[model samples]
Target chain A: MKAQKFWPWLIVTLGAAYFLIPLLATFIFSLRMRRNEYTFDAYVSVFSDPKFYATFGYSLSVGVFTIIVGIFVVVPAVYFVRLRMPWLRPFMEFVTLLPLVIPALVLVYGYVRLYGSSSLIPFTGSILGTDILLTCAYVMLAMPYMYRAVDNGMRTIDIGTLTEAAQIMGASQVQIIGNIILPNILVAILSGAFLTFAIVIGEFTIASLLNRPAFGPYLVGIGTNRAYEPAALAIISFIITWGAMGMINVLGRFAPRTSARTD
Target chain B: MPAFLEVQNLVKSFGTNTVVKGVNFAFAKGEFISLLGPSGCGKTTILRMIAGFERPTSGTIRVDGEDITHLKPNQRQLGMVFQAYALFPNMTVGENIAFGLKVAGMPAEQRRARVDEMLKLIGLLGFDKRYPYEMSGGQQQRVALARAIAPKPRLLLLDEPLSALDAKIRVSLREEIRAIQRDLGITTVFVTHDQEEAMSISDRIVVMNSGNIEQLGAAHDIYNRPATRFVATFVGQLNTLPAGVLAGTPGERAIRPELISLAPRPETDLTLTGTIADLHFLGSVQRLRVDIGGTLVNIDTFNNQTSPLQRGDTVTLHLAQKDLLTLGA
Candidate 1:
């Protein structure tokens, strides 16, 4: 019994140390911007910088767009497939997973190849077109997580009976989707949104290649130009991503259990 | 009187397999009809067709002279309760009950009052704030019932609403559902595989087999005068005895276990000597399996015999001519 307990404790301690040590070192180094005596000058500098506000705000809005697009694209596809065309699941799963197997750089390059200048649809010709292209890319990138989260959340409740119940009671299509489907899967959607937000905020390749001033490229710009502020930015980025993950975890606990599944 | 709900020539086919083959039935207003059948008998398919969930391949469904066969489910003004767990888990009991009323654009005060009335009808008047997951299965089902009827829909459809609960709750909830239906005077169509539940709750039962309705009548008629052997075997316990037991006839006889008695009476039409094969004590009734030469027949009698009869004991089984069933093929 003691030996069994020892192995898990040792494994957890090692795992925690492996992840926490680098973040702790970066945090400690970030506090040393003022030399011999420790200070929060690095963090203060990152906070007060005008570039930080512009890039962070831009990234935040882009993340929101990506999430909205993801919802509009994924929810209906999943709902329709699960309810009406269930045989399409295996094919849809493979399509959703393509984002994971195909690297981000390859996807962006393919986008550039297909929609570059002198092409039929020159998306990269204008800044707005480029932003739209980037948002679409992010939607594709986050498909795996968003699809699974929505599907799992949907699994916990019987949507078919609920839809039928609502419909027979004089609820139209919009009312059924808005009042019945959305509320039931709200937790899953939020979880997926937060995850997509975290991914978008720190994403560098697409935003940089598209010449957009996203926070990821700004972080790289700072890292290459300065020393201590880079650590501060890294810590801040870690906090934001961790906060999103924390929200996902906390919201997951509130989703109704499947024991009362009605179908 | 014109039938309030009329189903004419209803047929549904899924791909190559035909489920409901041109079935037709109609009931008057305030009638409680149950579609009773075994699994895969197209009973639920017919109910879904009526509810507008499944489109009939042919024929039309009319309610009060309005043809609603092509109408969407929402436009049909029907209240439906599913088998189990159809209550919205995210909403409270009050919200669930008031959902239809809210959708219908009822003012807040009226919706709240109607919700409270439904809660009171279901004996859960004070449970407005309770979410579905916080309640038991039976309570949640009752909330679903309240939700379905709060809109005072034109017709109420129940698709095996009490099949998920335990035996005790299933019985009591069904009784409560029947009483509530009577109180509201709503025309209701229920679907269930439990014949006893249908017999007790429905004004008339439609006994279905394969993809067709084998018999449709009151429970007493369905049991005593079954239209077919499928109805006889499906509705109740039936024992087939050789005709030789009835003073040497050619064909077999179908009789219910309880119709045959151990004690002979003045009106007893036939008496057969048989050896007691097995005895089953079913609380108020004891079922006996008797062997009369090569034929075996089941006999049920009152459980008044304190002394247990041995398997080899000779006993005389009594039957009445009126109790013998005439079933079609």
Candidate 2:
């Protein structure tokens, strides 16, 4: 019995170590100023650079903006398909998950063809060349995760009952969505928000393809410029992503415990 | 009071299956009516239709003579307690109770006052701040009831509200529900599969079978004079004996177990002489399975000063003619 349990855990531990080895090496490399001599020089130098700060701040703002837009677009769309037009569920789910199936770089290339200068979508000419394109691409990349999270959350409750309950109490559709449905699935939304942040913050494919001044491109640029500084930046990005996921997991634990009502 | 809520030929179907077929019933003001039946007999479906959760395939539903078949559940001002209680987990007990009123856009002060009133009414006055997960099943059901009633809806619909509870809790909460319904004098529609529950709490019982109303009337009439074979077997224990029209009616002379007497006394109108094949000795009553020719008849007798009969005993079973109901095709 002991061996049976230990074998699976040992394999998992080794699997975790395999994925984490480069991250550990990057952290150690960031800490060292010279051969095996530890110092905080790389971190201080990276923090002092305005370019690094700009990229970090830009990532945070883009993460927040992408999530807000995604929630506004996805929550009602998902709730509608789930509750009202159930016949369209499988189709809608397929469309939403299509983004995940296609490579992010391929979609970003398509975005450039559709919205770049002398492209089909003329309205793209009004916005700045890369920033708008980048934000829109980020929205596309985050669609599958955000939509599934909200959809799963909405599925856990009697959407009809909650809506009817709110309606009977004299709430409009907007109020029902905001007050009752959203509050109940707040945890799912939070998890989705963090997941979106992680994907956008460390996302390489779209940022590299678009050649935008985003965190991923900046990280790559730093990696080519100074070895230790790039390692420090990578560790910082890892910690940010880790922190977001950790907060999400803590709330996720309470979700099932409270899901009895939804049932 | 006249019928405050009237349903006319309400019908619903799914694909080829008709779950509720042309059900028409009405409830007077302050009446507690139970829609009782076995599983898949359309009891819950009827309740859902009334609550505006399910749209009828045909016919009309009217509350106070106004048609409401097209109106949404919330639009109809109907408060419903689902089988699972359907309490909001994230909200406090007070907030759950106050949800309807809050949706009604009542002022904070008025809603607070109404929540207090409801908490007292449901016997959970001190549990306002507690969430639904903190409470037991029975307690949660009570909160659901309190929430349904708090808004003072024009009608209350309870869909198998006590079915999830244990036996003891079921009885107590049922009584509590009936008491609250009585005190408030609200016209309430309750659905349940348990016949005893329907008989105990309802002023009228609508017994359904196979997507149709089998028999409906006062509980006494439904149990004592069941109109169909389905109802007879469904409502209570009944004993069947085959007799080729040695009788008045074709499906005549079927005796209920409770109405069967062991001895043929002067008051007995019908008598059957048979050999007891088996005997079951219950504390209060003895059930004797007797062989009458090729047919087996069951007779129930109350344990009074009478001695217990043996399995092989030959006896004459007596029954009142009035207790036997003749079913027709």
Best by lDDT: 1
Please identify model 2 stretches exceeding 4 Å from their true place: A1-13, A34-36, A117-132, A158-171, A208-212, A256-263, B244-251, B264-266
DockQ of 2: 0.39
Question: What's the lDDT for residue A26 in model 2?
Answer: 91
* Local distance difference test, candidate 2: 0.82
Per-residue alpha-carbon lDDT of candidate 1 for residues A214-239, written as tens digits (9 for 90 to 100): 99999999999999999999999888
Model 1's TM-score against the true structure: 0.94
Task: Provide DockQ values for all models, in the order shown.
Answer: 0.55, 0.39
Looking at model 1, how many pairs of residues clash? Answer: 0
Quote the positional error of residue B162 for candidate 2 in Å: 1.8
Highest TM-score against the true fold, candidate: 1
What is the two-chain DockQ of model 1?
A: 0.55
Residue A201 lDDT in model 2? 86
Task: Quote the B-chain TM-score, candidate 1.
Answer: 0.97
